[model samples]
Target: MSVSGDKIRHRYDRLAPWFDSLEGFLEGLIFRRLRKRLWAQVQGEHVLEVGVGTGKNFAFYPDRARMTAIDFSPKMLEQAKRKRERKQLDVHLDLMDVQSLAYADNSFDTVIASFVFCSVPQPRKGLKEIYRVLKPGGQLLLLEHVLSSNKMMAKLMNLLNPLMVRLVGANINRQTVKNVQACPFKSILVDPTSSDMIKLIRAVK
Candidate 1:
């Protein structure tokens, strides 16, 4: 991993124990429903979930889908492993970075990420790695909070982003849709789940 990647991993490692508690209220009020909606559209047998933080999405995993989930933070993955054991979900969890995936090219039929790209050191590199691992016609599903299109809100987010990153290791001002579009995905469809900031993106390779 790069220096920036190590920093992000260490930040999340420290945050792992308090992560669910910190985001509990928001998760209940908004993210839980959005997660279900995102996972419902998952297709194909082989699925790769990037950034499986605390295994929050384990409840939504398709029964027949072969799930292989990866995360860069070992502490976070430890939490996820415990959750997977308790839930008895058949998921293969690995410690891996999205910017440099260990999987072979065209190995997975579907790739999923939830609010993850914001922390990635090189977002485009990670997107390209996803593109490389996905089979032709494969789908990439993302649930992300991005920079608001509103000028004032966007400016405010940009101003606050550095502090946000320092505090939580996530940027609040990423234009995730544009980043996905710049990749080689054949089609991109975006739906605003919570105003224009939080989006559900579906892109095809």
Candidate 2:
């Protein structure tokens, strides 16, 4: 891994134990609805879920979908494994980086990424990799926070990005929707959520 990737990995390693606690309150208040919106639109059998932090989305997945969930942080993956075991979910968990996927081209029927692109050191590279792995006409479902279209909120996100990254390994100002649109996908659809800071995206490959 590159220096930046190593840094992000180390940061998540430290945060792994308490990461769920941090997200727990918000999950019910805000995130669950967005997750529902994203997962409800998903269609496919073979699925790959990137950034499967603590396996929080495990319950939302349809029982019929075969899942492979990956995360760059081993510690985070460990926590996710516990969740998988507890829930008895049929998910294959791997420690993998999004920028360089291990699978062959056109491997997955569907891809999912929730709050993932923000922390990737090379968001475009990661996006491209997701594009590469999807079978033709397959879908990529995403629930993510992005740089707000509102100028003042955008400025606020830009201002907090550095601090947020240092604190939690996430960038607050990534224009992920734009990055998704720029990839080799056949089409892209986006729906605003959480005051336009979060989005539900469906990109066909």
Candidate 3:
């Protein structure tokens, strides 16, 4: 892992215990519905979920799909493991980095990420790894809070980004759609699900 990756992992490890509680309000008011909508589009039986922090999406996972969820933080994965068992969800949780996926090429039929990429040390590299692992015609689904298109809001996000990263290991200003477009995905579609900042991005490999 890069120095930035190491720092992010450590920061998230430290934040693991309080992770769900910290975002509980937003999860209840907004994220839960978005997560269900994102998972509802699952295309096939094999699926991979990146950045499965504390298994927030575990409750929405498709029962028919074989799920493999990965994260770089061990403490976070531990929390996720407990959630998995508590929920009685059949998910494979692993301590892994998105920028360096261990799976073979064309391994999964669908790849899911929610509120992830903003914290990735090398977002494009991680997207490329996702592209490499997805089977041909497979889909990538992402629900991310991105840099706002509104100039004033974007400037504010950029100003706050550094502090956010320091505190939570995530950047508040990231052009996630543009990063997805830069990858070799066959097609890309983006929907602004929350104002113009949070988006539901879909791409095909």
Candidate 4:
């Protein structure tokens, strides 16, 4: 990794604690609806989540599905471990990077990412891996914050993105949905949130 990327990663390691704390609030207020919507499309299968911060989606997954979640922050993964301690579930949480995943090609039946595309050092490379690691016909479920088509909002996000990434380890101006659709997968469902900040999309590869 470059020096800048290394520095950015160290920043995330430091912020993991605060990020972990917000998982509950985020899950209750935001992810609940998004997860419920995507859960119907992907269930009872071998599932993998990239950038699986604090394992927020672990509970949302159906009981029958075997879930393996990977994240770059060890501290974040440790917090996730604590959260799952009481729930006897089939979930394996790993501290791993997204740009270079260790899993084999076509290793999973489904792949999910929730609000994760923003901070990845190379979002396109990570998406390609998400594509390669999925079994044929496997679904890719994504809940992403994206660049708005609204000119005013887009301009605002572009202005804030660099500072946001520096302070919060997040990018506010990523074209996450467009990047995902650029792959070979056929987009089966795309439900854009009315306000346009987030979108729930499911694609079949």
lDDT against the true structure, per candidate, is: 0.93, 0.87, 0.91, 0.78
RMSD after Cα superposition, model 1:
1.8
Best-to-worst lDDT order? 1, 3, 2, 4
Q: Look at candidate 2 and give me any clashing residue pairs.
A: none
lDDT over C-alpha atoms for residue 201 of model 4:
79
Clashes of 1: 0
Q: Please, what is the TM-score per model?
A: 0.97, 0.95, 0.96, 0.89
On TM-score, who's better, 2 or 3? 3
What lDDT tens digits, residue by residue, belong to model 2 across residues 1-205?
1239889899999999999898899998988877877788778889999999888888788889888999999999999999888888889998999999999999899999888888899988999999999999998988888888899988888887888888878888888888988898888887643467888888998
The parts of candidate 2 lying over 4 Å away from their true place are 1-3, 192-194
TM-score of 2: 0.95
The deviation in Å at residue 52 for candidate 1 is 0.2
Candidate 2 — worst ten consecutive residues by lDDT sum?
A: 190-199
Candidate 3 error regions (>4 Å): 1-3, 192-194
Q: Is candidate 1 or candidate 3 better by lDDT?
A: 1
- Write candidate 4's Cα lDDT for 108-134 as tens digits: 998988888887878888888888898
Q: What is the lDDT of residue 120 in candidate 1?
A: 96
